[model samples]
Target: MKNNKPKYNSIIDAAVQVIAENGYHASQVSKIAKKAGVADGTIYLYFKNKEDILISLFQQKMGQFTEKIEHEIASKQNAKDKLLSMISMHFKQLAADHQLAIVTQLELRQSNKDLRLKINDVLKGYLAIIDDIVEEGQQDGTFRSDLDLRLVRQMIFGTLDETVTNWVMKEQKYDLMKQSKEVHELLVFGLSGNTHP
Candidate 1:
């Protein structure tokens, strides 16, 4: 519906930048409208309120993020390679967009419980991708057969999430993309460096 309109995207992109720059609490709808080059009323035409905008922004950005990761991993033949591709793409996407990284890693976490729940709903798609990869690995004996699916999914997603959070907290001082290989190795091999028997 309204999503196909150019202004919708403009508003979402503007929300990301404004929220990232101002912090979600300090960011006003008027500021977002101005950033989008739209009248304040125009924002309401697309969103119910500021919370709606935040949820929409996350849904839109994460949709694209999941799609890109899917595309990147599709070419890999093995679960290990697909897993690495997923991690690499995750790092590359955030590293390429500092504003988005800030909004996702910091501002979004500061929202209320309801808003956080909605954001978590948006994340389910991304988590499903990780689950698929882990299941593939287990099926092919690339990962331990005894591994708990839910636990493994949480570990993989948590590792990637925390890594990005650390990078953002440190002001992104180093190369996030460069850590993809090591992170992949850590996830695949564990601290003991044991391979599947």
Candidate 2:
């Protein structure tokens, strides 16, 4: 498929930077091609259109994001540490890439309904990581076994997602990574309860 070719990846990377810098609506195929060091027509060989480029970019980046998080959490023996690692990785990765932050938190949200659904499809892998941690925690007693798994997953993802969105909105004036531990504490032990783990 297109994923195997170097130009495909170059185009995806270029699209991220172009979309982040120009805003998705303002970004043109030629601009992406220029940034990618390829001809404009070359893009069509890899992607069907600008929207396809955007979706592909999310798939490529989120794929790497999920893989790194999985590896980082694999080293930990407990679900608490694994969950913390996931949070840290989520914050740290976005914090390290400002352009990517803009593209993900701002530009990506502006996509149309069908595009949004496609983007959501790309998110399934990351969500699965959260599901595994929650299920493991519940099974091992590190988290409240009585908690609803689906609700817990939504809560965890929503909290992390909103935290990053707020950070992005603030122009990253504060340290995103610093908030990880506190967020972890809140998710693990909840607002009012005995700390577990």
Candidate 3:
């Protein structure tokens, strides 16, 4: 962490806030710099443009998220616990970072289709984690082998995303982690092959 790096990071943090509070189109470099408590030129030094900020923010935050989930899940003994831990962690992390959550869930998608496709590349690591867990469960006889792994990946991501969106839309009145367990259980219910339980 260099001194200038903190300022740059502050700019990035401010970018997330500005984009979250104001829509992406509404956010400007001066606005972000103002929120960041730095001059306008400081922002341009760290970011090429507004679009760069959004993509960099996603890469930086989502990278850390993927790393943390990978580390957390590694300690768990079974595929089920690993999968469940991942879901709980994903929701809880975003719930903690409200500004980033708002930017990610609301503002980022408001960008054009091309930018979103690039963001999806950043998302692939997180999705791959889910796919790995699902595959592990299948190998261990805990999940359905016949289920399409790609479809299962979408379900987990989609359900978690929808749950978080609902939480955000409701003004975040309830515990997101609690909702995480429910989401995970619903996912397990669908993915697991135990019909009689």
Candidate 4:
């Protein structure tokens, strides 16, 4: 198969770092190219513009992220374990990618409303994974019957997002994976059909 993927993945990676460090408003094509170790013209070969670059990066990384999570959860039979695996995978993935963590946690949010909306599309994969977990939990009678799956999904994502963002802002001084179990407990307690251990 043709390795038709971007000949300049390094450029995309550099763009991510540049955007993370410089913020979207301040990020420039020249800067990204420099960081990627390519001429500025090379970026145009793979991307139409800065916005396209950002969108592509998110879509690519998040897709791989979802795949890994899907594989991890598939190995578990219990919905509760699957849900925990899902959360753990997400936190661990972002935690390991410090540059990606910076871009997602802070810089990406700094984009304009239109850009944010586009970025939201890339995030749908992650969101859908959470929704699926909630559905599985409901089906297995582990979650509340009256639960608004959509709202519950948002709550789980929001809580986890906030947690990771705070840790990043704090310079990631602690272990992200170690904290995953506690988050699982909080979400499971509030949303699960049975609150008691």
* Each prediction's whole-model lDDT (CA): 0.92, 0.89, 0.85, 0.83
Which ten-residue region of model 3 has the weakest summed lDDT? 1-10
Q: Roughly what TM-score does model 1 have, to 2 decimal places?
A: 0.96
Candidate No. with top TM-score = 1
**RMSD list, candidates in order:** 1.8, 1.6, 2.1, 1.9
Give the per-residue lDDT of model 2 (tens digit) for 3-82: 89888888898998999889999999999999999999999999899999998899899999999999999999988889
Cα misplacement distance, residue 155 of candidate 2 (Å):
0.9
- Cand. 2 TM to true fold: 0.95
12 in model 1: Cα distance from truth in Å?
A: 0.7
TM-scores of all models? Answer: 0.96, 0.95, 0.93, 0.93
Residues 51-88, candidate 4: write the lDDT tens digits: 88888878778788889999998889877888789889
lDDT of 1 by residue, 113-136 (tens): 899899999999999999899888
- Give Cα distance to truth, residue 111, candidate 1, Å: 4.8
Model 1 root-mean-square deviation? 1.8
Off by over 4 Å in 4: 1-6
lDDT of 2 at 111: 39
Q: How many residue pairs clash in each candidate?
A: 0, 0, 0, 0
Q: Which is superior by lDDT, 2 or 3?
A: 2
Off by over 4 Å in 1: 191-197
Compute the lDDT for candidate 1: 0.92
